[model samples]
Target: MRLEELMNEHYDEFNENDLHILKYVLNHKATSSQMSINQLAEACHTSRSSVHRLTKKLNFAGYSEFKVFLKWESQPAEQESRHTEILTNDIEATMKNLADTNFELLSNKLVSARRIFIYGSGTAQLTCATEAQRLFAVVNTFVTIIHDQVEFETMFPSMSDEDIIIIVSLSGDTPALLPQARKLNAKGIEFISITNLKNNKLAQLSPAAIYVTSSPTATEKGAGLASFIPFHIAIETLIRHFAEYLNV
Candidate 1:
C-alpha cells in the first residue's frame, strides 16, 4: 500500500498528538527514515510514547517498519529520474544521427512516390495516423495509414511500383511486420522503416530506415520510457522537405 493511502484511510482516526507526528513525517519523509524513534519524537516535539502511538495508529508493527515503508516509497522517483536522464542522452544521439543522414534524399523519394501507405502496429500506430494526417494536410497527396496489420496487408496485391510503404514500430521486431516486409521484398517494393536504432530485422529488410535510439537502460520502467519521438520528428522533417520539393 502507498503511504498516501494509509494516511487517507486513517486520517480521521489520528488524535491531535498523532496529527502532530504525521505532519513531521509528511514534511520530512525522506529524512525521517534515517532517524531513530527518539530522534523522530524530538523532531516532532513529542515524546517517545507519542511516536509509538502514531506508528500503531497507522497500522504499522513498529517504528522500524514505518521507516522502511517511507524509504521504499521514496525510491521510485529517484529511479525514474535516472531513467529519464538516459532517455535524454539517447535523444541527443538520435538527433545527431538524423543530422548526418541526408534527409533531402529521403524527401526526393517521398515526393516521387505515387501512393504512400504508413503501417504501425501497437502503440506507434497512433503516430502513424497523426503523421499521416499532417503529411496529407501539408503535401496534399495520396496517403493511407492503417493501424491494423491485416487491413494493411489486404492491399498488398493492389500495391504498385509507384507506391511506397512506411513501417513504424517501437521495437523494430514486430511479428506482424516480418511477413509484411517479406511481401514487399518479393514484389520489389522499396519501403521505409521507422524503428529503434538497433540491429533489428525490420531495419535490415527496409530500403530506408529512420532510427530513434532510446536505450532500454531502465528495465524496471519497462516500455514506459521508450519513445516514438524520432518517428514524429522524422515524419515532420520529411514533410518539410516534401514542401520544399513541391514549392507548396
Candidate 2:
C-alpha cells in the first residue's frame, strides 16, 4: 500500500500530535526521510518515542521501515502518457468481470431481505452508494443509506439476519469499518461489499463482493489521482442486472 493508503487505513488511530508530525513529514519528505528518528522528533517538536509509536500505528515494522517508505514516496514520478489508456483498459476489464460475475445469490438475498442497508467508508464511496440507492429505488427496492458512524452504530443493534448490508469501500481495509465488519460476521448478518480490490478484509468477510479495478495516475510529485469511475460502472451494472433479475 502507498503512504496515503496506510494513512487512510489507520487514520482513526492517529492523534493531533501524530497528524502534526505527519504533516511535517509530508511537507518535507525528502529531508525527513534522511533524518534519524531522534532528529525527526526534534524537528517535529515531539519525543522520539512518540514518532516511533506513530510509525507503528501506520503498520510500519519500525522507524527504519517508515524512513524507507518516506524515501520511496519522495522519489519523482515518471510521466506516462499511457495513463488514460491504462484506465480505459482497467474499466473494460472491470466491466467484463461484472458481466461474468454470477449475481444470482446476491440478487436472491436482496429480494428476500426484510431490509437493505448501505454504507460507505468515505465521501466518494458514499456518493457511489447513494447512486446505488437511487438505482434500487427505481425498482421500488427501497435501500437505506447509513450516512455516518453515529447513524451506523445507532442502527446496528436493530439489524437482524433477515436484513442485508452493502458496503462500499475503496480500500476495504479501512480501520473504522473493520470492527463493524467483524461484529456483523459474528452476528451472522449477511453483507456484500464493493471495493477496488478483492483480496481485502472487508471482501473476505463478505458473502458476496464486486471488485472494481482502478489505476491511479501519478503526478510529478508522486501523488496519485485514482479514478473512481469504475466504481460507478460496477454499481450501474449490478443494479441493471438486479433489475433484470426482478424482471422489472
Candidate 3:
C-alpha cells in the first residue's frame, strides 16, 4: 500500500495538530522525506512526540519508516504513453475486480428492501449517486438521495432493517461518514459502500462494499484529482445486475 493509503486508513485518528503536520509533509514531500524527525517537527512547528504519534497512526514504526514510504512516493515512475492510458488501466483493473465479485447478494437486497437511499460523501460521489438514482428510476425502483449530513442524521433514526443505504465515497475513510457507518453497524442497518479500491474503515463497517479503481491525477493543493469514471461504471454495472434480479 502507498503512504497515502495508510494515511487515509487512519485519517479519523488524526487530530488538528496531526493534520497540520500532515499538510506540511504532503505539500513538501521531497524535503520532508529527507528531514530528520527533529527537522520535520521544527518545520511543522510541532513537538517531536506529535510527529512520532502521527507516524504511529499511519502504522509506521517511527519517522524513519514513514520517511521511506514518502521517498517511494516521490520517486517518479516510468511515464505512461498518455493520460488516457492511465484511465484505461484504471477501468481495466476495476472491471477485473468487478468480474470476480458476485453482486447477487446486493441485488437481492435492493429487490427486497422496503426503501432504498443513496448518499455520497463528496460532490463527485454525489454525481455517481444521481446516476444510480436515474438508472434505477427507469425501472420504477425509486431511490431517495440523501443530500447531506443533516438529512442522513434525521433519517437514520427511523431507518430499519427493511431499509437499505448505498454510500458512495472516494477514500471510503471520510471522517464525517465513519460515525454514520458505525451507527448503522450498531443499529443493524444494512448499508452498502461503493468506494475506491483500497482497504478502508467504511468498507469494513458496511454489510457489503463495491470497490472501484481510480487513477491518481495531479494535486491542486493537497487534494488529488482521482478520476471518478470507474465509479460511474461500477454504479451502472450494479444497477444492470439489480434490474435483472428484479426482472425489469
Candidate 4:
C-alpha cells in the first residue's frame, strides 16, 4: 500500500507529532527521498527521534527505508514523462528477456502432453481462451481453459501425468488460483506460467515460466494488468513454435 493509504488506514494510531511528520513526508513525496532525517524533522517541527518513530509506525525500519518508498512513488511520473524513451527501452529489454527464455523446453512440454489446459482469470482469460482456440484450430491440439476452482477440481479426475496446465498471471499472486496451483504441485502435475519478471510464487511453483519485461504504460490503470501486449506476444510465440513441432 502507498504511504498515503497507510496513513489513512491507521489515522487514529498516530499522535499529533506523528501526524506532522507523516504529513510532511507524504506532502513532499517527490523530494522526501532526498531529504535528510534532520531536514525532515526540522520541516515537520519535530525532532529526529520523532521522525524515526514515525517511520517505525509506518512499518519501515527507519527513515532510510521510508525514503525508498518515497523514491519509488516518485519514479513513475519521471518515467512516464519520457514516453518514447521508456517505450524503446522497455521493448529492447523485453526482447532481451524473450531471447533469454528457453522456448524449446516449453515446446517440448507441449509436444509431450496428451492434453493442454490453460488457466487464467479476468483479463488474462482472454489470452488463455484465444490461444487455446487458435492452437486447436491450427494444429488440432486438445486444449481447454480452467476458469475456477470448481472447474479445475471437476477436471482433476480426468487430468493425468500426460497432461499439462498453463497458468498466466501478471503478479503471480492470484488469491483464488494459488491454492489450485499448490494442489496440482502435490499431485506431481507440473505446469507452466507466464508472469512478471519477478520471482513471484507462481513462477517458483511452476516447472516452466515465460518472463516479460515489466511495463504498465499500456494499461489505463498502469497496474499489473498493463502488459497484455507482452503476455500476448509470449503466448503467440509458444503457439507458433508448438504448431511448427506438430508440422501444422
Candidate 5:
C-alpha cells in the first residue's frame, strides 16, 4: 500500500499532530535516513522524544532500526541494477536517497480518496502537476491541477472528506502557498506534500510528505538532475500502486 493508503487505513486513529509528523517523515525520510535523531528533530522543529514516539507508532524499534529498514527497502532490484548504477555518483546518491524515501512513503500509506487535487507554483509547478495528473489517470482516478490561488479557493468548497490535495515544491517553503496550506489544515483537509527540504514549513503543514534530496543547483551543472528524478520515480511508483489497488 502507498503512504496515502496506509493513512486512510488508519485514519481514524491519527490525530492532527500525528498526521503532521507522518508527513514530515515520509517527505524527508530520504534525507532523514542519513541524519541522527537530533538532526531529525531540528529539521522537523520537534523534539527527539517526538521522533522516538513516531517511530514507535509506526511499529519500529527506534529511529536507528527504521533507518536500517529504509536502507534495505531502497535498494534497486536486479532488473533496475544497471539503471541504479548510473546513479552511483553524488547525483545518483542524492536521487537514490530520494527515491527510497518516496517508496517508503507510498508503500506505507493506504489512501482511498475519491479525488485528488494537485497544486504547484512557478514554471516547474505546472510540469509537476501535469506529471501527477498523468500518473493518477492510469488508475482511472480523478485529479485537478490548480495553478492560481483564486481558482483553488473557488474549488475548495467542493472538496469533501474523501478528497486529497497534493502540493509540490523544491524549497518546501513557498510564501504564497504557505498560508493557504495552513488554512486548509485548519479546515481539516488532508494533504500530501512533495518537497526537497525535510523539516521546512510546508512539510510541517502537510499530513503526509514526500521528501527529495538533490544536489545544489548553483554549485554544479547537473546537481539538480537527481533532485527531480525522485519526483519522477515517486509518480511512477504511485501509478503502479494505484493500478494494483484497482486490480484488487
Candidate 6:
C-alpha cells in the first residue's frame, strides 16, 4: 500500500501530538530523510521517544527504516526526469506540469483550509494573485495574495487560528517573508510553502512545504532560470481540488 493509504489506515491511532509529527513528516520527508531521530525531534518540537514510538506505530522497525521509506515517498520518481527536461525547454511540457501540480495543491488546500492567504514576491507574486482571484470566484473562500511588506504586515493582525498561509518563493530564501511566516506560526496559523530549495529557512518555518527541482543558477547578466513550471503546476492543482471540494 502507499504511504498515504497506510496513514489513513492508522489515522485513528494518532493523537494530536502524533498527528503534528505525522503532518510534518509527510510534508517534509525529503529533508527529514537526511535527519537523525534527534534532529527530527528538534524540528518537530517533540521528543526522541515520541519519534521512535510513532515510527513503530507506523510499523517501521525504527527511525532509520522510517526515514528510508519517507525518502522514497517524497522524492520525484525517475519518470519525472523526462518531465523536468520538458519543463526546461518545452512549453507544452511546462503547461502539463503546471496543470498537474495545481490540481494536487488545490485538492490538498480545499481539504485543509478554512481561510487562505497567499504570499509571493517577484514573478511568483503575480502567479499567487492570479490563482487567489480565480479561486475566490469559484468558492466562497477567502484568498489574498499580499505583495508588499507593509501590505503583508497589515493583514496578519486579523488572522485567526482557522487561517492558513500559502507562501510562494522560488528560492525558498526570501528574508522579507520570514517575519510574516514566523508571526503566523506564533499565532497558530499554518503554512504551505511552494519553493525549489529543500530544507531552507522557508521550508523550516512552514509546517508543510512542496519542493520543485530547478535548473542551475544563472550566469551574470542572464535571466535567472529557476523554473516556474512547478509553481504553476501546484497552483493549478490546488484550484481544481478546491472546486471539487465545493461540489462535494
* Top TM-score model: 3
Model 1 misplaced stretches (Cα beyond 4 Å): 1-81, 217-224
TM-score of 1: 0.62
Residue range 75-187, candidate 1, lDDT tens digits: 64434357667767777767765775667777778778887888877765566656766676766876787768778767888998788888878777888788889889888
List lDDT for all candidates, in order: 0.74, 0.84, 0.86, 0.73, 0.66, 0.69
lDDT of 4 by residue, 1-248 (tens): 44644564355568998877766766677777889999888887879998898888878898889888888877754445554666666666566667766787888898888888888756565565667667666776767878767888899877787888988887777787788888888887879887766535677577776776656554446643254666777777778877776777
What local lDDT score does residue 197 receive in model 1, on the 0 to 100 scale? Answer: 66
Residue by residue across 74-189, what tens digits does model 6's lDDT show? 77744433435545643443344344343545456546767777777676556766776676667766677777788877887888878777788877777887777789888988
- Which residue pairs show collisions in model 3? none
Better of 5 and 6 by TM-score: 5
Worst 10 residues of 5 by lDDT: 217-226
lDDT of model 4 at position 117: 86
Candidate 2 lDDT trough over 10 residues, lowest sum: 1-10
Q: What is the C-alpha RMSD of each candidate to the true structure, in Å?
A: 19.2, 9.3, 6.9, 9.9, 8.7, 8.4
C-alpha TM-scores of all predictions: 0.62, 0.66, 0.68, 0.61, 0.58, 0.57
Off by over 4 Å in 4: 1-78, 82-89, 217-225
Candidate 1 versus truth, CA RMSD in Å, comes to: 19.2
Residue 104's lDDT within candidate 4 is 78
- Model 6 clashing-pair count: 14
Cα distance off (Å), candidate 4, residue 126:
3.1
Which residue ranges in model 6 land beyond 4 Å of their true spot? 1-114, 140-142, 217-222
Candidate 4 Cα RMSD (Å) = 9.9
Per-residue lDDT over 1-248 for candidate 5, one digit per residue giving the tens place of the 0 to 100 score: 23433343355566666777777767765676777889878887878888787667666789898777655544544443233444444344444545545544543343566677888865576687898788777666768898888988888888876777888787777798898888788777788877764446777677776665543433234333334665565556566765675673
After superposition, the stretches of candidate 3 with alpha carbons farther than 4 Å from their true spots are: 1-78, 219-223
**Pick by lDDT: 2 or 4, better one:** 2
List clashing residue pairs in candidate 2. none
Candidate number with the higher lDDT (2 or 5): 2
Question: Better model by lDDT, 3 or 4?
Answer: 3
